[model samples]
Target: MPPYFYKKRKRGAVSMNYSQAVNWIHSRLKFGIKPGLERMEWLMNQLGRPHTNILVVHIAGTNGKGSTLSFMRSILQEAGYSVGTFTSPYIETFNERISMNGIPVSDSEIAQLAAVMRPLVEKMEEELEESPTEFEVITAMAFYYFGSVNKPDVLLLETGLGGRLDSTNIAEPAVSVITNVGYDHMNILGDTISEIAAEKAGIIKKGIPVVTAAENREALTVIRQFAAKQQAPLYELGNHFSAAAKSRGEYGEIFDYAAPSLQLTSLMTNMKGRHQVKNAALAIAALEVLPLSLSEKEIREGIRQSSWSGRFEEIISTPKVIVDGAHNTEGINSLIDTVQRYYGDKIVHMIFSALKDKPYQEMISLLSEASDSITFTSFDFPRAETAENLFKAAKVQHKSFEEDWKKLLLQKMETMREDDVLIVTGSLYFISEVRNYCRKNFLEK
Candidate 1:
């Protein structure tokens, strides 16, 4: 049967709420690189160009974009400005992609908007020369929802893929942020570092200030050249701003950051990993250039209150279970560093999987250093690499290949003692599925 055939099952069904409507939309739409910005521009145009009404902080990079956006939203919200955030590839629900004032969009609201967008989306498919991709339609819906109700003062938009031609790059941002360049999506964004850097640097708009985390010399040079050409003020990490963690504990990390004009001391953040301190620093630097009214106190408080899930997240208490969406080599390296720092000399059981396109071999090589044993599993996505393929590549000692992931995870949990830690990671899709399973069976009362 065809993919669209599934949609026919619920064709005439009335969605009781927004959550259901979003589910229906996603059922029909697929994910991947549907290149070109014209379709997204057209979709937004149909929605009355909601991007113009709000101040957008567009962020792009191979990694750290989500963490940086989380920190920025916290700071802006603490400063007493209403903030909205839009991110991609949610861990759990589709609503996770859109937020109002730091909260996830409500189920009822999502359903209502889905109902309204359903007809428009269908019309576009029939009338327009080509149908907008899944991300494009959803991007339009998010902007419309944000504009229609409680128009926020600012919106932190994270790109779905490459920045230059990404669907989310249509907005004229107040400030652009690119968090370090690394080897990712090589097929689509070129195989060289300079090539990837150029794609990410596309987010740097003319005359807008851009804050970039410390990158390699070659990538840094490319970004600086782009900034100079665009006439945008470039704030590079370690030059204009820097951050270091003073102390780190199970609950959170304490860090100090210094931007060009603002200095903060011992800010508490619920996020783990030392890389997060750098992300927070980049966010502070970007906020420094914004014209919005804010104070140091607000920045400090926002840094403290910001929390993003599934980035080295410790879910369960006894026999501690951790989940991280470390799909790439860069992200896996960061996760490995955090594991070594926090759980020194402790053995770790790793549950891992990734997409077929990712550099799984490189990621597995790095992870093998920290992992004691591995339980390979696949996510419910077409591109997910199978357990057998991952197991063969890693060449690690493992256990039985249980058909059910939830059952397999629970069985592994039974073997783990209070001191042992199980790290569930690989792709965001696997992390999201594991998170949903844990919430339903283990975490929920």
Candidate 2:
């Protein structure tokens, strides 16, 4: 028997077993070319639109959406509302994409849900004569699960690639948030900032309120036009709300935020980097636009307690192994700025890799300015740039390159004294390999 068949037999004669369901998804799920609202509408219509009962918050942007969603989820949960959050391109596992009340769905629950939905999805595929994408299936599963078990008071839905065609746009959101716009997914969205902003602006529904961070003039114009056409209330960060850093040090950043209805001062965030402060501000602004009443004390407490891992995350502090998922130009600039601001004039050893589609050359060119040495590595993905490719790129910039990242990293750690920083970045996928290497070699307990 085949591997999947063998596994199914081992699990006993269940028609749609866990392994089988996973296999089915793997076989059917594909990326690219599928766009528009028709597929999601059809799926939801088939399922009776369970999202109508759930209070939804739609977040879209080229960057910072995930971190902002994290901040919002923490605050809402702290304020005693049951919350379900869905984010894409998970750092570790597929199950990480869906969370209920800030906890990931149980593996058995995911398996059971996949098993139940597999047949229905397949039937839909045949009946409609068009197969649903991987994202659509998982989205449907998340909506159904959130409705059945958590029935959350609020749901934070982050757009996958772009907003107009993203599966998460199906929800009639109570509030829509645009973190900021930048150049990414140009192949699908568009090449220009205005075109991309128009795609993201699709999440702005009629008569709904939108909270947006400060954006460039071009992107803001597109968003403003959309809001005007839809008659959605727009709250721009600097105009309608603002946050200023009260104090920042090695501990973390503390900022004061003035929202429409609430003023929170000295709100300390555990997340590192100055850009995180901006993400917090956007989350606070979103909360301000909501009808739910929250005291200043509650807002302060929520801001102080919000945590989002993998954004400038420090895994090991001894040799100072920092991992950040700064794959784009804007994010890379933020990471470089943060490192300089915190650890000034210090030499940084960088371990880097990126997806084939990303602006890897641009990212590397910027990073080369701050990095002391570069170690090229490959991540476990089909589209990941090979270590050899990265090494060649580093050579053009006259930077030192180590092709065997594992061996080279161990060598560096053994030779370097304290005070030197080691940064593992470029892609979140590579961070896992770096972490595993550290755990086996250096980290104890």
Candidate 3:
């Protein structure tokens, strides 16, 4: 084994198998979501302070963080630069949280990184009164993996929770990017957009350039104040940079993007939604603000090829089976807008589920506006809301609940006519399950 795999803690350190390591990390959820930087600081100090060694693009937002990061990563990759990313709520595998380019870190690498973090995790639990949460542990692992081992040219870091107290905020990033700010985690982040924007603006470091795609005036005011206080240059969407959708279809979008230094018409993306155009434009603006060298061709091709999982992804074309991870009101609104644009004439049936902590009721109400029939379903997650509860909350007439999502989905698809669309959405976790099921069962056939 390489010395850097475990760094200086190779001696007397406990070695854990992959499953044991992952389970140990997930088990930290018992401590709940303790949001603070003190424990994270102490853990990083013990791990040789690796967070300071790498260049990062810090991204914090409510809905578009993952997709914006994907666009930026694909652009950088298209420009022939290697990129590392840190995102939360893994859709496919636990290792997906820490990845290079688009491929997740190998299981052996995860085992090695877990081995390095396990001892430190134990030390923290013994020394500190409050143990680290699951997010903090994963942040530590990502820091260990990227900051110490297999470092990439650029690391795109996404905040797990609010930006100020988020463990990922410990890193000093070259550029601070906020995809968009909206009402989410109201209990922890605050109830209003201004307060939430304040939390998102916490990532803007002193003298670092800040770029935002937030469209709300209240949110923009808060971000502007924060950036000005930090003396950070601010490049805002619909101001310094903008994107206008020219066309949208079931498979893709074509848009026009413009910035002070660059303007390109008819930019296209495989990813659906007008919001995606805004995300791509924000990504390009962030890259422009950075010191990296990139061409217009790379940016165009990146937008065209970049694909994000669990964000309006089409699973099977027949009956037009689409799945999206729209758990919040803002996300549902965006999904509905896309639906109206593409599937207004078609019969759209939306199957939904979400975490108990989210604003699932309002989300369901918003979803009912576009969906012809809404099916409420729950997954095997600790926080997932009951299908009956979601169904009961729906004010719309065409609504039902099913404990078994597979049966509901099969029935929906089997009964749908050629002009109908079946959408499975609610949470990213749920969409990932549906995505895997469809890939294994329908895509294969």
Candidate 4:
């Protein structure tokens, strides 16, 4: 342990209720996405390096990280192993970021964890003259919870941003999984696929196995080089392991998976889109490479049980409403493919809202291909693009803007014909809001 890891801070425990704790954490958003690990390293050190004792499956990628993590978590749970997962950009509640057996950290646990972090964060600010970002703070909480509070058999750690500099990168993982690399965080990661791939490959460690579904040649080459440099075994999706689609089943995507150790047919994911199949395949490959032995039954049952919300998630049945978290161009492309394949015959109405930082123009352009009728709408977030600004990105025949997403959703839902499908796309945050509204007003009723 580093000498500073034992920084004897003369401080009292910061007390807080649930709301106060959450608000305090949210207030750190002003620090923004400062992409570096100096703060995390310092904070973890002060916390006595709680992350070292835990076994982690460090997952990094632009998009599929959450879905892949869910697959692994489900399978491990099915195999009767306790699994803890740390993921970002929660689809529902803030406590969902740190979970065990798919159950979110409790409100009391969240408050307690926040209390543990408050003092350390204050100490870091005083010593380093810098505040940790919201993500960094949460990563610390996960480490503390899983490390000191309750130690699970394994932890699925998802990088909040780029792998190398993300707050969650301190973990010494048993296996490193990169779902895929793409151009999402260009400003922080880099402008090119190679740069981004290298950033994602930062989780690679000596002798650790790497599993990736990255198909882009440039991205794959960068990943291969990083794996070689680290002397880690590389498992490419289409090369070392592969998932071939059999059909889009009633529940989700059905496919056949093949890897060096095992091969299985009719492996199904309970999430829509072909990309989900790749995620499930990556999950299987990642688990196979882990130190534990997972049976074929566990793998199949686990993948079949796993479902990620806000990714091609269908919220309503009649006059079907689909909510997808396709904030970037690559994700938008996948959404477009799913739409064309499933709702091709229906008259699709697309609602989109994204953060200003995302490639909303390209995303809007791609949504146009999936549905000519497009409506741009904004949500209650700092980075959310204004509905009018999002409207400017669309070049479709039927395009409009609505400042009130609820009003638009209600108007569209009430007026949808029998052959119409309503899709709410764009930012995960926006979709999260939409999902909550639907659950309260429609699904619950």
Best by lDDT, which number?
3
Instruction: Give the candidates in order of TM-score, highest first.
Output: 3, 4, 2, 1
lDDT per residue as tens, model 1, 1-445: 1223223325433444655676666765754558788877776676677777788899999999999999989888887888899998887787889987767877776766676566666767788857666787778777777765557888889998889999888889999999989999999999999999999999899999999994689899999999999999999998888887899966678888886577888888888889988888888888888888778788888888887888998888777899999989999999998998888677788888889999997888888888887777786788898887877787555433443578778888899877898998889988988888788877431
TM-score for every candidate vs. truth?
A: 0.92, 0.92, 0.97, 0.96
Q: Which is better, 1 or 4, measured by lDDT? A: 4
Score each candidate by Cα lDDT: 0.82, 0.78, 0.89, 0.88
The clash count for each model shown is 3, 0, 0, 0
Measured on C-alpha atoms, candidate 4 has an lDDT of: 0.88
Model 2 segments beyond 4 Å from truth? 1-17, 31-33, 395-398, 402-404, 436-445
lDDT score, candidate 1, position 299:
82
Residue range with the least summed lDDT across 10 consecutive positions in model 4: 1-10
Question: How well is each residue in 340-372 modelled by candidate 2, as lDDT tens digits?
Answer: 877777878887888888888888888887787
Give RMSD to native, each candidate: 5.2, 4.6, 1.4, 3.2
What ranking emerges by lDDT with the best candidate at the front?
A: 3, 4, 1, 2
